[model samples]
Target chain A: MALVGNLRDLKLPNLIQLNCMERNSAKLTIEHAGKYGMIYFHEGQVVHAEFDPDIGEKALFRLLGLPEGKFKVENGVRAPMSTISTHWNNLLLEGLHQLDTMHASGEGKDRRLLEMFMSVKGVRRAAIITREGEIKKGDFQDDKEFALQALSFYEAEKISGLLKKEKSQFITLVTQSKRIILTEYDKDIIYLDIEAKYQLETILPFIEQVLI
Target chain B: MINRWLKEITDIAGVEGVLLVSDNGHIIEKIGTQLDQGTLEQIARRILRIITAHNLDEKSVKEIELICYNYRILAMSAKTFTIITFCGSIRALSLLRITVNVVVGHLIEDKKSMKQIGKYTGQPEIVLEKEYLDQLEIKLISKLQ
Candidate 1:
């Protein structure tokens, strides 16, 4: 749906456009009616996003879960004002359920799971990637690729560890201006790696929450 | 063997020193060059106090692998032991990761050594004035370090 009002009249779109134009690194919290979404902007690019219920990587995957090839961004020049309210909330709840499972399994502290949690929390839009040779949204079209690309190398490693019935030795998630990497090591010390380019601002808060 | 492992870890991360600490902030074994045993002990004590005051459960504290700013302090845990690494601010993430990984592996494999070290160096077992403990707890939870 066309954003119901002029870009200037919509607080979210205006803030997003302004931030995108200035290349600011900050978190934007947007609420419409009772639904809420947060978009993190880094260097004027929309790198990470979330809505009322979902906050980090889970948010991105949920967006990926949208029918393959059916995913389309209408009015790429202007943000959608239709408020994907139900979709966003559903994703948030789903993300929370996943988090609860991880926490209960004694795996909440796993860096990869934590990164996924951060990427999905409060997110509603696809990440904007500007890095060269970096995999972004197209990877989300395939579930496996999406999982590998969206998580850090450390997270992939953790998954591999679980797959092999090995104890996870270590997990690490590192984000720079251009990329997010997750790495996991098995108790026997094999490594798994994943990488993607998105804005760091959107992901930092989630990381902080997980770490702190 | 402990010295050899510490040397390997320092080589990996450019770590200045490493220490084994109890959850209560007692120092067990410390190794490396140009070490600040006193200051490091104080920092470890402060970290424990901070962890306790914040009411951070075991799960929450285990998630913090590294804390970096002006200087870098890396925390890794295995059951009852916490391994703390001190490094210069300029250390790279990869280097830090390798160092933490090697030390953590070695620590896990050498639990007996850690316990023996703990026995010899026996934590200072300080008894803080009640008011001092309260003030420190307040400062720890409220301030960012």
Candidate 2:
């Protein structure tokens, strides 16, 4: 039989620690917002992970960041492949540390950054959104469309991992309805709506300034 | 001839690889020997799906530049094909954009390339499944004491 529960009730780190201390080989699968992530433990050590468009350590970090989800743990289920070699203790610590950093820098900082984005000349609107497309703050009339545009960052983040590149600085898209500029700030996606008359390049410096 | 056009983009500094994928996710042409064919195909398919999921295709998004810390992925769309580039340390993106424009122009006008693209016009795209996770579960269950 498998252990199944919600992440809201039991945080992932606690679950990871529980499995590790028990020295059980298990597979913990998490489903959030229609996406699935898996972590495989072999004798108390994390051996593998799989998240859509990500595997190995990258997948582990992403899984760790999930705030809420449904999780299942099947005991004695060995990993098909081992994509991680870090000790469980170290892995857990690192994952938790990254989460802490994101939250610490995220909350109060987003509003200031959004205001800075709006200050840029030729900027029509600015919004800050979570990775799951939730609008944390924005003034856009069509919030749904705005959130959808920000979702484009997920592909960039995935591709960057595949290419072994650094974190993305910004993404610019020229779509039919709007000219958009997007950046990752404190784990939140900050996007801007630009006027048709303003050249994107000319507006980049301001965006860069706010990022700095 | 298509590979030759793609090579122009790969030849640029910081560019690791380039793939010209059809609308339905077929790799019409590619350059950069460092990345394997399977990896390139998967990347192409993933990007195409993302484009469709976000309705970027319907929005007529002409150009997209995903600028990362140490690398970049640039995609330029023509009506029939999209050029996806994996680049490292992009120091001259303007030059790369120009090169892509020229190459895409050539592809649009090239009769042979257009004919090849037409073959894949109505083909269904490959969708990914998560059967590996389930298979692992079954294998482990069978091994239970």
Predicted structure with the largest DockQ when compared to the true one: 2
Q: Report the lDDT tens digits of candidate 2 across residue range B1-145.
A: 8888888999999899888888767887777748778767766765665455344324566778887756677888877688998888788878999999999999899999889877776433332223321342223222221
Quality of candidate 2's docking, in CAPRI categories? incorrect
Of the true interface contacts, each candidate retains a share of 0.00, 0.58
Give TM per candidate.
0.41, 0.60
Query: DockQ values for all predictions?
Result: 0.02, 0.21
> What's candidate 2's DockQ score?
0.21
Candidate 1, residues B1-145, lDDT tens digits: the string is 6666666666654577777777666777677735456666665664444234323322223423322334445566544456777666544756665666667677667866766655644232231224434442333223221
Clashing pairs in 2: none
lDDT of candidate 1 over A1-212, digit per residue (tens) = 42233222443334445566766655554432223445554555666666545545544433332211111122333332222333333544565565556557544434343333333433223221211112232113223222222222222233233333233222332322113322222221212222334333344444444333
TM-score: model 2 vs. ground truth: 0.60
Judging by TM-score against the true structure, name the best candidate: 2
Error of 1 at B59 (Å): 4.6
True-contact fraction in model 1 equals 0.00
